[model samples]
Target chain A: MPTSSKIFISSVAQDAITHLRIGAFEELSRLGHDPQMFEKNFGPWPNFQTGVDHCLKKVSECDLYCLFIHTKGGSMTSNGYTVTHLEYLRAVSDSKMMMLYCESTIMDAYFKFRWIIAKYIEEFKLSQGRMPHNNEVVDFLEMESEKNPTSGIPSKHQIDTYVWVLLHDIVMVKGHYVEKLSWGHTVPWASYLSDLLQQGLQLLPKKSLYEESSQLALAFGDFTSFAKQVVSDHVRISELLEGRRLLNRSIRMLTRSEITAGPVNGSIGSVKACSAICLFHHEGNSLTVQYYAGDTNGNYDFEVGDPSSFVSYTYNNLQDGVPGLFYWESRRLFYLTYKLGEYVISYHFPEDTAWSSQLYADYTDDIINGILNTHANGMIIELLNSLIGGLQK
Target chain B: MSKKPTRLPAAQDGWHVQTTANALSPDKTVIAVNKQGTVLHMQRNGMSAIGKDTLLFVPTTRYTDNIIHHKHQRLNELNNTLTGLTVEG
Candidate 1:
C-alpha cells in the first residue's frame, strides 16, 4: 500500500497563485500525503548553501513535482534564470514526474505575440535593407506606440518577452501535457487545483516491497548479484509474513495468556510480558530485545534475550509503575536508531512568539501523563499479585 | 485675351482622362470626349485614364480603399496561418 508520499509544489511567489498554492498544500495533507513547499516546510538553511540550492535539493527528494505558470516568470536567480525556471529544469533533469499548468489567456497572447514579432521582423528587413535586431524591433514598437497610442498594437508590458521564451521551451517538449487554467474573477481556482492534485496522486505508482528492500541493501553495501538474490529472498519471506496476519496472531497470543492467568492479580503482568514477546516475535531475527528491571534507588537488572527467543524489559528509577513509560520511550529511540539507520539527531526550538510554544508544551504534557497512568496501573496490579501470592502460600 | 482654354467634356464610364497622352495607342484603346470636353482612354490593362487620373475600371471603388481592404484581408489570413502552425505549442 502507498502511504504518505512527498510532493513538491513549484511556482512563483506571486499574489495571483497564493490561494492555489495553499489549496494544494491543504488538499494533499487531507489526502494523507506530505506536501513540501519552501514557505511551509523549509527551516533555516545552513550558511554554505543558498536558497536555490536548498530548493533544488527538495525537488530531487520529492516523488512528484508540480509547476504553476501565470503571467510573471518570477524573480531571477544569480544565473539570470527565474527561480521557477531553474526548478523546472531541475525537475526535468532528475526525470521527476511533473504536472504543468498555465493560464489560458497567457497562452492565447503568446501565439498572437509570436505572429506579430514575425511580421515586424519582415517589415523591418524590407525597409532597412538588413534584419533588425530584437532590441531594435522592440524600440521601434515602443516609438510607434508613442507616436500613435491608439494603434491597437499590444505593448511589451502586455505580454512579457520571457513568457514567450519559457512557453516555447515548455510547449515544444513532446509527450508532456500542459493543462490550461482559465482566468476569471469567478473561477474556483482553489477547488480546481485540489481536484487536479488528487487526480495526480491517483496516477502515482505504488512502491513495492522488493524496491524498498533493494534501497535498504544499496544503502548498506555494494549491491552485487549475491546481494540482489538475498534482497529478493527477503522480500519473498516478508510477503509470506503479512502484517495483518502477524497482528492477529499477536492478539490471539495475548488472549490465551490472559485466560491462563484468570482471576489472578498477575494477569496484567502476564499481558505485558506476552505483548513484549509478540512484538519481538514479529520482528524476527532482525532485532535483539533487551529487558531492564530497576527500582527507584537506581538498582537495576538487565537481560538480553537470544535471537531465537527475543525478550526485553525496562524500568526507570523514577516513580513506581512508570516502567512502561520508559519502555515506550526506549522503543521509540531504538526504532529511530537501528530501524531507520540514522545516528545524528538535531533539535531546534523556536522562540516563543505566539501559541506554538504553549501548544507544544501542552501536547507533550498530555502524552507523558497518559503513558504514566496506563503503565502505573499495570505495575500496581503486578505488585498486588506478588502480595496475594505470598499470602496464599 | 488667352483665347479661352479649350473646355473639354467629361469622360464616359469605361474611359479615364489623361492630360499626358504621350503613351496612348488607338489600336488597343477606345477613346471618348464627354460633354465636359475631357479626353479619356481605356487601356488594354483594364486601367482607364482620364486627364491624369488612373483608376481601375472594373472595380469602381477608390484605389486607396481597395488597397487597404486587400492588405487587411491578407493580414487576417497570415494571422490564422501562423496561429494554426504554432497552436500545438
Candidate 2:
C-alpha cells in the first residue's frame, strides 16, 4: 500500500520557478503526499528568530527534504550560511531523505551581453529622460528581444536546470550519494518531476511517515554523549592553565633583576679609583651601573669631557652610555655623591629587606675604610663577596 | 488523516507477504508468510488464504508501488474529518 509523507521544499526565491513549485506541489498532493514549503507553512512571526525556529521545527518533522540551487548563493546569515544552506544542513543532521538539484547551464555570452545592453538602455532612459539613440544599443536591445523573448536575468528554466545538476553531482543523502536527475535538453519539468515522485515514493518504507528511525536515534544519542564529555574535559583544562599562568606572571615580576658584579681596581685620567656593581629589581630603574676608578686629579670632567679622557670602565650599561640613571630618581629614591680626596662610595639601600640592607651597609663601610686608611681588611672583603654572590632570599 | 481511496490497496495490518520462490514467478499466484506466523496464499486480486481461514479475507483493489499513497490518504482523511474538506494544493 502507498503512503503519504511530508515533503519539505527548500530553495532561494526565484520568480521563474513559481509555476514549477505550484505544479510540483499539486502533483505531489495528487499522488497522496503532503508538501510543505516556506511560503505557505511559515507563519507571520514578529521576528525572524521565531520564524526560523518554526521553519526548523517543520524541517525536522518532514520526511523528505528537497533542495533547489541556482547561481546565487543567497544572503548570508550570522552563521555564515545562507538561509537555504542552513536548512540543507539541518536536514542532513536529522537524516531526513534529501534530494538536491542545481542549475548548471551557463548563460551564453552573446545573449548575456545583449541583455546587458538592453538593461543599460532602460536605465539610461530612466535617468536621461530619452531613449538612447545609439545605434549599437538600439540594435542590441532589438536582437535580444527577438532571440530570447524572456527576462534578461537568469530564466526560471535555467535556474531549475542548474539546481538539478548541482544536486545530482554533489549532494549526499544519508550515507549514500545522490544521483542527479537529467532534467536538461528537452526533458520537460513535469516528466522529470513525475519520475522523481515515483522514485521517491518507491524508496520509502511502508511504515508510519512520522515515526523516527532507530538508526538516527542511536547515532545522535552517542554523538551527543561524546560531545558532552569532550566539552567537560576542555573546560577543566582551561581552568588549570589559567591558574598556572597567573602563578608564573607573579614569579617573573618578583625576580625581574637578580644579578650583581665587580669590586675591581682601575684608574681614571691618572686618578686612582675603585668600583662595584648591583642591579635594581624595581620597575622604572635602569638595569646598569658605570663607575670611573682612580680619578685622583679630579681634573677630568665626566659628561663634558670626551669619553676617552677618563680611564673609566662601563658595565651593565653594556649597549648604552650610563645605566642606573633613569630609575625612580624623580621620586627621590635614587641618589649619588662623591668627594675628591680619599673618595668614598656609599649607598642607602631601602630598609625593606634586612639582609640586603645589612649587606649594603657593610659593603659601603669597607669601601670607606679602604679609601681613608688605605688598608683593606681581607676578611671584610670575603664577607661582602659571599653576601653579594649568594641568593638574598 | 485522510481516508484511503476506494480503489487503493486494502490495509494489511502487520503483514508484508512476499513470494518464497528463488525468482518470483510472473503468475498471478504466490505463497508468503507474515511475521505473525501465518501462511498466506496471495493472488493478484486478493488473498486466497489467510491464517487457516480464521480471519475474513476480502479482496481489495489498492496495491500499487506508490509508497506515499497511504500517507496522503491519511492526510486527506484528517483534513476532511477536522474541516469537512481536503486542503487545497
Candidate 3:
C-alpha cells in the first residue's frame, strides 16, 4: 500500500477561510498525503450536476475525512441540509475515518446558545401549545441577539443556527467529539490549521510494506480461488466465450478506426498499468507504464518505461474474436491480452529471473481472475440471455 | 400581599448582582441589577452590558475592574491573532 492517503477536507466555502483552506491543502501536500478541498478539487462540474452530489461523492471516495467547523453552516442542498452537513453524513455512513476541528469561540457560543434555545423552546411551548419550528427558533435567536448585542452570544448572521444544530448532532454521535486541542483561537489560523492536519495525519493507521503486500496477496488468492471455481463450469465458459465473440465483433464493426489507447498514471504501484484505451474516441492517446521493485528495506523503486517498450505485440487476432494470452518460452515473457469494445489491449510481464515460480504463477493467475470476474461476468450474463432466448425460438 | 424582592449581593455602588446557572460555567452566573431595579447581563468582554430580558443570563463571576480589564486584554489578543484574515461581511 502507498504511504499517502486521500484526505478530503470539508468546510464552508466562504472567502473568509480561503486562506485557511489553502493552508490546509499546502500542509497536507507537504506531509505527502493528497488533500481534496473544494477550492482545489471541486468543479468545473457539469451543468446538470449538483454541488452537494459532487462533494458527497468526494467524501465517500476519501480514505479519511477532515472537517473544519467555523461559524457558517453554508448553503442548504435540495435535501434541506447544508452541503457540509450532507458531506459529514456521507462520511459517517461510509465509515470514513474522521478528524474534526472547530473554532473555539464559535463552539463555546454554540453550547451556550443551545442551552438558551432549550429554555426558549420550553417557554414557547407553554404559551403557544406547540413546538416551535426550526425557522422560528432561528428567528427568535436573531431577535434576541439583535436586542442584546453585548450578550456574548453569536447572532444568527454571525453564526448560522444550523451550525449550532450540526454541532449538537455531531456531539451526540459516539466517539466523535471534537477534542479540546482541536479548538483554538490563540494562534494564526494558518499555522493552527497546519498543526491540526499534521496531528491528524499522524493518527491515521500505518501499515508496513511487508504486511500490506501480504494482505494484498491474500485477497488476490481468495478472489482467484473463487473465480477459478466459476470458470471451471463448461456451460458458463462456453456462454462467456460466445458473448465475447459477439461483443468483440459488434465493437470492431462500429468503432474500428476510432479506438485509441493511453496510460493513466497514479502515485501508487497498484494503479500503474500499461494501457487504458478509450474505445470509442481518439481523445486520449499517450500511454505510460511504471514498474515497481522492492528492496530489502521494504521500499519500492519505481521504474517508468515507455509504453512502446512494454507493448511488444499489437496483433489484430480478429479470427479468434477474443484476444488470446501468449507465453513466449524463449524470452520468458507472458503477454496477457483482452478486448474492450474495438480495442485489443495486451499487458506484458517480463520475466524477473529472481522471482520464485510460485510468485510468478500467483501474479498471472490474479490478473486473469480479475478480468474473468468483472468484465467477463457482465458480458456473459447479457449475451447468454439473448443467446438462450434465440435458441428457444 | 406582595412577597419581598429577593435581596442579592451588591455589585458596585448602586448595582445588585443576580447569579444564575449558565451553560458556559454552571457554577457561576453573574448579572448586574441597577439601583432602578433594571437587570443587565454583562458581556463576555466585560466592557458593556445589555438588558437581561433580551438574553439568557450571561455567566461571569463578581464583576470587578481587574477582571473586566483582563477580559478586554484577551479579546484584544484574539483580535490581533486574526488581524490579517478577511472578516466576513
- Model 2 chain B: weakest 10-residue lDDT segment is B8-17
lDDT string, candidate 2, A1-393, tens digits: 655678887777766455556666777677677888877656665464665667777788887787755545454466444567667778877767666554434323222333254346446766778965433343444454567766343343333222322232232112223322233322143464566667656745532332334334344445544544344333332122342233233222221111111111211001022222122211122211222222122223232211221111122211221111111111221112221111112221111212221122212222223222222222222222222222221
Instruction: List model 1 lDDT by residue over A1-393, tens digit each.
Output: 655667898888878888888888887787677898979997678779888899989998887788777767577676656778778889887777677777887766554444344456556665688966534654665665566665444455664445554564465322245666776432343465466567655644433443454445444333233343344234332122343344334323322112011111111111121222112111332332221111112122223332111122111111221212111111221100011111111011111112111111112222222222332232222222222222222
Give the per-residue lDDT of model 3 (tens digit) for B27-62: 223233343434444433341343322211222111
Ranking by lDDT: 3, 1, 2
For model 3, residues A11-101, the per-residue Cα lDDT tens digits are 8987766666788788778867789988787767767767678888889878778888877888876656788888888988777767777
CAPRI docking class of candidate 2: incorrect
The DockQ of each candidate is 0.00, 0.00, 0.01
Error of 2 at A29 (Å): 1.5
Candidate 2 regions exceeding 4 Å error are A1-3, A44-49, A106-393, B1-89
Residue-level error in angstroms, candidate 3, position A320: 73
What fraction of correct interface contacts does each candidate retain?
A: 0.00, 0.00, 0.00
Q: Which ten residues in a row have the lowest lDDT in candidate 1 chain A?
A: A334-343
- The residue ranges of model 3 lying beyond 4 angstroms of the native Cα positions read A1-3, A43-48, A118-136, A147-152, A172-175, A180-393, B1-89
Question: What is each predicted model's overall lDDT from 0 to 1?
Answer: 0.41, 0.36, 0.46
Cα lDDT over the full model 2:
0.36
